[model samples]
Target: MTAVSTEIPQRRELVTELPGPRSRELAERRSAAVAAGVGSVMPVYVARAGGGIVEDVDGNRLIDLGSGIAVTSVGSAAPRVVEGVRQQVGESTHTCFMVTPYEGYVDVCEKLAEVTPGDHAKKSALFNSGAEAVENAVKIARYATGRQAVVAVDHAYHGRTNLTMALTAKAMPYKKGFGPFASDVYRVPTSYPFRDPEGMTGEQAAQRAILAADKAIGADQIAAVIIEPIQGEGGFIVPAPGFLSALAAWCKDNGIVFIADEVQSGFCRTGAWFASDHEDVVPDLVTTAKGIAGGLPLAAVTGRAELMDAVHGGGLGGTYGGNPVACAAALGAIETMEAEDLAGRAREIETIIGDRLRELQATNPAIGDVRGRGAMMAVEVVKPGTKEPDAELTAAAAKRCHEQGVIALTCGTYGNVLRLLPPLVISDDLLREGLDVLADALSPKG
Candidate 1:
């Protein structure tokens, strides 16, 4: 047996079947204990994971393309992260960063300030989930700008809280029964190039959204305008080139705090530290969580110091906002990102996946569009020669890929978009293998 350390295991092994019998029994028990609303794409229970691979309880080893929904960018069981967590846990688990501050928490904040995009003086506040980070960004914006109304893009996925749910555009499961959402939240059109009128430029789409915001809410009353550089659950939708910068300029001119919800696209998932880098549109505030801590639960809102400090003392934070162990994990994750050049790796994956996806689009007439930035990408499914969504076929393709041992996710308002967010550290060969599986799954017969 290999000695455990803060490093990747030297070997990849799968000894049991996928979701071995034991895992199935445990899953049944879990289903009984939890609400049915919480879903699982693959029922295989994880026994252990290292690098870009996850070993199921049943002994089947599978490449992890999901990265725990983009949370484990450095790869599962990263050595530094594991070591840091071990040390932190051995010292102390929780004191609530608010009650008694610790070095790990402070260190994370320091790192966030130094690394987050803008050259301006920045500050950061930690949270446990992307939703909390987003909610806190809104709170800070409202507090800073002294405005009540907030604007968000169509098909944005903010969070589950009342205010965030209001910011979010999807209704089916997120907003379905959760009635009485927060008010003063308005939705504006996003620069969805695939669906835009032919010949429309990115600037045109931004103007359309700005016009809607101006007329509907009056840019003056809007405290903040939040958008994901690349819409995540809304289907890895990458906006046009000039769209984000135009919107950012508008927000700046109107004194509205611009927020980039990089929850799913940050931490080098899209070839850069943040997807915002793709457009060089620095926002007043940036929310991040998914890949920040190498699978440990950690999220943050980094922004201009003045705005972040606008909140009164004790106005922000949580019991487990910046847990010491999580902070340690974040430190390790950041180090791995810088040292191993995972950002470059993400770009490489993009080239490989992009080329393959374009080829698939050419072969599969049902694929209406293939779009995304860096490793964060998607293929939109539609009826051949028409825009009608083919969610059924999308679901089937995902199921087939799963049967072939590849885990992929489907998104989009109509659930017709297949998104790819494999860990940045995923080997090119493994990634290509997964894409081959996807291609076969998409074929007329598999």
Candidate 2:
């Protein structure tokens, strides 16, 4: 197969209505064949995606601000990723990493250790999704520390699997009806600056959470304290300054493994290799996915060698855990990140998008908060005069943006956050245009 063009025009152009006839037909077919549980942010069917635009089957090109929920950070069909996938497909797709390993898998693991935070000697185990990585990280923590209790924080989102559902805090879509979740999982308060009492410092908030965990689940019994340094689905919540470090310190002092779920915040998404680097905090185990393979199915748990090796041989191996093709794609993705300095690009995105969103907040009282790091940013919508979440307004704004040839996503526990995860490779012009579309969507008339 030929490589996808990286030169696809970097502008949004509507050739037809959103979800035009072709997309409508595809939607009908999808409804019939696909499971009802599967959800989509938009009904438009993508025909080609590259750079900052997702071209639908109806020939309408929409500026992508979601980046497939923070995947494709190097842009959909990044040239290097395409090349790597193509080469790997021609050679071998799978040999079962457990049965017969390839150099690609090891190479990806080595890259993970190098990119993830901390200077300690690290080892890695590959998986197929963020949820799998998280589950494995928890398993490693339990095995290494010989503790059964796990602590997840409020407004957290880990994944949808049984164990992850127990860890995830939200219930509506992610956890509802998913019953009999894994045992010994506990929830604690997190340092949510926006919702926390005014003037409460990060240290205080951290102490509050620590006390809750200690009181509820004794420190000796806790295997791990997992968190998203910047919560993803719970809103692009960047915890108060000292929150993460304090938590890491507490975990260290108490023999609880600190696992940072960087699935959405790692790989230069937060202008760094990992969000933990922002505070100079080091996690004992870090779960990474989303941007890891540049749109391929790949995930990993990278951590201290001693902890990782605690799992005996044959304890952690899946049929397709480290598929050779996906591993190759990850190698290419890492190469692109390094060659293009995408971390620096993410910082640039922060400066550009952050300034614009703050300006919008100044004029729009409904925008209760503007927070996030680097390319991962969001605006929490609320009532005009109060902090009451406005999920209706958030949904309406998202609908308007979708209709106007811009892809925007809504998140947050209350469903009131308009998140923007634009591809780091997006051009300055496209970024501003997408933001303009968002502003228009949130306008009074809209």
| TM-score of every prediction relative to native | 0.96, 0.98
Candidate 1 residue-wise lDDT at 377: 82
Give Cα distance to truth, residue 203, candidate 1, Å. 0.9
Question: Could you tell me the C-alpha RMSD of candidate 1 in Å?
Answer: 2.6
What is candidate 1's lDDT per residue for 303-326, written digit by digit as tens?
A: 999999999998998899999999
- Cα lDDT of model 2 by residue, 1-446, tens digit: 11124867777999887789999999999989999999998999999999889999999999999999999999899988999999999999898988888999999989988888888999999999999999999999999999999999999999999999999999999989879899999999998899999999889999999999999989999999999999999999999999999999999999999999999999999999999999999999999999999999999999999999999998886999989999988998899989888999999999998999899899999999999999999999999999999999999999999999999999999999999998888888888999998998998887
- In model 2, the clashing pairs are none
Off by over 4 Å in 2: 1-5
Q: Which stretches of candidate 1 lie over 4 Å from their true place?
A: 1-19
